[model samples]
Target: MQRLLDGIVKFRRDDFENHRDLFKSLKSEQKPHTLFITCSDSRVDPNLITKTLPGELFIIRNIANLVPPYRETPEYVSTTSAIEYAVLSLGVENIIVCGHSHCGGCAACLGPAERLNNMPHTKRWMELAIPVRDRILKEIAKDDIEARRWMMEQANVVEQLKHLMGYPYIYEKTISGQLMLSGWYYIIETGEVFIYDKNLGEFRLANG
Candidate 1:
């Protein structure tokens, strides 16, 4: 708590002050170019990783960085709404669904059946992992927990990207070339980022 407060003080005194003009313009309005979605993992800092400024990347972070397929349910879901707005309203050109190494949520998804029994809501939510689970089971089934876990993490990103496209507005935008979607995997320890390259059939290092 103290560290965060001190950091806030430093930002107020140094960082914000040094960029007063940028902040002043942001005060009036914001027009971000991309919508970055990633895990709510503490170590993953979207702004820091992307080296983007305050009003550059609109972001959404969740437990597994999951984006549910487009639906109009009785309940209100904030993440879906954010995606809709980011695409149709903000006209954000790029949407990046990022998964990461050593994700607890991914590990849990790949683990025992008992894991989900305790948290029914989580169990239900993670049904979205079904496609990912099946893909991993068929292609790269491994006894090593760590290896299987990370494979599921990467596969989950691809699954979520498809879910994002399931959104009608997102699909239309993508088809018309008004929007571009990307899947990224961030490795925490090495500070290496791999971007899903559709043509290469591999995760390639992001150059810029």
Candidate 2:
């Protein structure tokens, strides 16, 4: 699109010029400290939210920000393999599973199956969040649309964090204090971020 092209030109002229030294250092190799996993939603910009620079966050994004529980398969698993590379190969210190409000993927998971009849691949991918859907159904009233949506988004983040622990390497690193795990819920419209607290067992405002 023309917009993307114009943005690229402007970036090369302004942003790239300003960060020339940073880009040159990253030309050879990158040593990012965090593995940021989130949705493919255009609104959820990991770098913008975290205020991280290039080579600071290794990002892996997909629908609903779901992480498939670790399993060996001859078939290529995109999300699983990326996590492996970030953790074992790149040695990222932290992994954050972020989910945002009003996510189409999360909404689809909570909706009727026929709604996704045409999107077979996406429907299959959403199976990873079935537990999240189930929990929302059980705990929240069907008439409370806002409650259901908010719960689905936050619970999905926690669910993916659980899936991340299924990775043996990630688990070992976490146990040894080499890696940290976090679940985040971002409010797109409000610019608010909530972090899951293990002690309180609920998401709390990150700023406060």
Q: Whose lDDT is greatest here?
A: 2
Please give the lDDT score for candidate 2: 0.94
TM-score of each: 0.94, 0.98
Model 2 clash pairs are none
lDDT of 2 by residue, 1-26 (tens): 99999999999999999999999999
Candidate 1 residue runs with Cα over 4 Å from true position: none
Give me the runs in candidate 2 sitting further than 4 Å from their true place: none
| Model 2 CA lDDT for position 52 | 89
- Expressed as tens digits, the lDDT of each residue in 7-85 for candidate 1 is 9999999999999999999997779999999999999999999899899999999888999988899888989999988
Q: Please state every model's RMSD to the true fold in angstroms.
A: 1.5, 0.9
